[model samples]
Target: MKNDKADFIPIFDGHSLAGWHPVPRLPVSRAPGEPSPDPDDERYRRAMQTTGKWTVEHGAITGRQDPPGCGYGGYLLSDGVYGDFELLFEARPDWPADTGILVRASSLGSQGFQILLDHRRSGNIGGIYGNGIGGFHGINFTLDAKYDEHGRPIGLRLEDPAAAIEPMTPDKPALLDDAATGEQFLSRWKWDDWNEFRIRVEGASPRITVHINDGKISEIDTEALKHPLYNAAAVRDLLGPKGHIAFEIHDNDPGMGEARWGANAACRWRNIRIREL
Candidate 1:
């Protein structure tokens, strides 16, 4: 007999789980001399005095940085993976930091898409990187001048690269002129302020929306990306039906802080909620 009640399980706030996993909290941290925990690891690193600098209060996770590299940072990884869903989270950086909300990421470190939270360059927020794609893939979308063996910038444009690689339709060859793009994308950013990020993934296409203090800033469509590394098939097999969510405490160039041996930078996250559609 078919049972309609079996299709729904009541949880909280008038919400029900219909083939969707209830959100689970998984704590994470980095401590001295301790190997970094794998994103898939079930163990949550307890907060320590020197290494684990994050604190959890009222269900909100906050990130703290000690001089150079006391500990890299901390993250709360989701227990399950997600495919097509809407993710909502609140973020307020401690003294202007760079963080990333990575999805569709593989345990093998191969595939995923990152919604960048950049305190450094606001316009550059939500740019995609890594795995054969150059720095800031979608944010700027500028084409690199074709280079010869000598590394000199040839006048050839991306249209030429598209022509060389036949049968593949390159989405609008990126303009090679740097001045044409302008810096307006970076100028309208807020530093040291809490911002809301919304990422919607539907199949191979992903859309990003950013709101600063409830005011709309930018919206980007990432469907036209042709990078083979970000192909749908590769991501689907690696991340399964759903993908894991992670907060990145990227260790970039020095002068930002002291470079401690074996220490990674950090970031914090709170009020993370997702609704599967």
Candidate 2:
């Protein structure tokens, strides 16, 4: 038996997908009976650059998204580039998925630092966004799962998990805080199964720290960032020392137009490993 985790390493090799690739759809925002983008449609940018379907069967590493819900799509990169690390994985959502887990990722200027594997109903898996900069700036506390209009999740699990801070831009207007770490991540999350996604990231204006199922929640530190464009020579290579290691299939991009999930949702990873600290 190889229960793994001996200094982490196995970045998904249960079957295939090699080092991973495909990531070309982030123009999200067309709901209300969707369907618009036709900028000389190269077949809708090759079907939104093949938005979804990164298979690998039983061992894990699935994505799904496609014609199941509606907006935003493509994602699944990671060819190499890491800095201070500590990732761990085991996410598992079936339909209402809006996934996340990209640290330092660039994929040739896509941006990263997300760690939210949204599970729908005002999702926020572990919160820590910052994609391509601009007030998408990080920190979310989450835990509000209690949907029911057409979103689902109504199994119930909310003691109060709603916190947002978005500091550099996105038109401002998102600032709520109630910390209690939302009942400690709903008593170590597990709504509908597998859960255990740890993160770490170290210095150079990057302190991040999240955990789920293992509890913890949020701990960012981007050099005491608060937003107003927390400078550092304007996002120094995304506060870099290294990058790459993504996995988010969250199309409908309008640059985080809220709602966060519930379209064709899909997320599943198995024993993904990492450890560079």
Candidate 3:
């Protein structure tokens, strides 16, 4: 019942990690109180190769930066490569985390179309990012949640993070926008609760579509991308025709103010299933 349909294949077993392998995020090291080190240095490269921490908890596969809050993050890559498919999964990131699902990810260039679930200030979910392929963004909007006086998340808000803070409660449903608005997504996303993500990726220069909590957020055709940095042929060459699916525990960049991830926060996912198109 958790799958999209009987024909879809289950990717995660829920009780343990079986078909996935961890790959640490970029070797560029940046933890609080420590000066960044050279990524090409052999010691840093080897150390970061296994730095990420992943585990199973409460029927969900979870990822957290190792050593609780002070360590960097990584990704979980599927063992098999896929050409085109529809991926369905559920996720709940502890407040202020940055995470995503990768489609047809090329390990060589770190190239892929990422379905972002960056649940932090000025972040977004259900949007596509170019990753290392082109460093381009293909989203129309972002999200910023409400925080308590102590910086603990109290609720979600679709407005800019700089907007004046006023009284609001998560107890009420948002005034949902029409599907045509494309702005309907964040309002439909559950605050601090599990939300469903459905993604379809197809073609060489892939056409990607995303729906979160049953609200459509993005539909991008890479072959026709309008961004100045996007070069279709180059991206296609880097991605090839087939690649693996992946999940990310994003690297934290302190330059962007507070750490993008929460203290000891873990992003959780379960009921992963995929249907090849």
Candidate 4:
């Protein structure tokens, strides 16, 4: 069920990022965005001049890789921590944008439970992922480009998920309880328009249910999970009972022949509301 707007709290002000901060979500021991000291270091050249930040544009929270095609990625996390709640938002991404929502995210940017919105080639949107808690994926089919004669993406076609998944998420998530077919999702999602998402996350051992345009799409229950690498106890210890809500600006791994996020393309969000349960 949707939360009552009268009782809901606004997560975004619609004018500014008051309680949110951008963090470089890197998979490394070193601090994210810490430029290499030596000029000779290869990582030094990759240091972003002005990438990995979110901004308000035309009354929406917009996220993108800055300077057109720079190699950078990060998360925009809320300041407060929430235990269980229903989150409401609308997303309208460019033809090729790699973005997602995070619940129970760590402020340090390491761990989180993600609702996948990989809107590029060979990607899937209505899936779930264990970010740093455990590297797992939960999606049956991926999406491929369906372009018009103008060489612009018009819609998405379903494909085998094997080629698109990230390297980290090789196994199924600790618990992938329920999901809709890829064909069903494509039929429901409105292309080049805002799609409302209502997410309900509840229980100490959370059961996250995602609804797009008020239609149920997927569910994940981490309770009684038996996956080898996914330890529920360890994850809870790291993130605690309460954690921040975050958003992802996924990397454009140029070296690996991946253009997941289009150059300077943005994912737009609006009407972010939360109702703590």
TM-scores for every candidate against the unseen true structure: 0.52, 0.29, 0.83, 0.86
lDDT (Cα, tens digit) per residue for candidate 3, span 63-113: 887766654667888888888888888999987788888888866214577
| Candidate 2 global TM-score | 0.29
List runs of model 3 lying over 4 Å from the truth: 1-4, 27-49, 149-151, 161-183
Once superposed on the true structure, which residue ranges of model 4 sit more than 4 Å away at CA? 1-3, 28-51, 160-174, 254-258
C-alpha local distance difference test of each model: 0.41, 0.63, 0.71, 0.76
lDDT of model 3, residue 64: 86
1-277: candidate 4 lDDT, tens digit per residue: 5346677789899999998888775553222122324645555446434437689998899998865667667788899889999888999988678889989988755477888898887677867777776655776557777888998888778855566554324345325677777778888899889998888888876889888877778888876655656677777776788889988887767553336777768899999999999
Error of 1 at 75 (Å): 4.0
Off by over 4 Å in 2: 1-49, 52-64, 69-73, 76-95, 101-103, 108-112, 121-124, 127-144, 147-180, 184-205, 209-217, 220-247, 250-277
Candidate 2 whole-model C-alpha lDDT, 0 to 1: 0.63
Per-residue alpha-carbon lDDT of model 1 for 127-210, expressed as tens digits? 444321212244432222345799643432322334331221233223111211213432433444445555555564445444
Q: lDDT per residue, candidate 2, 165-204, as tens digits? A: 2222332213212122445667777676788777888876
Give the range of the ten consecutive residues with the poorest summed lDDT in model 4. 28-37
Name the candidate that leads on lDDT.
Answer: 4
Question: Who wins the TM-score comparison?
Answer: 4
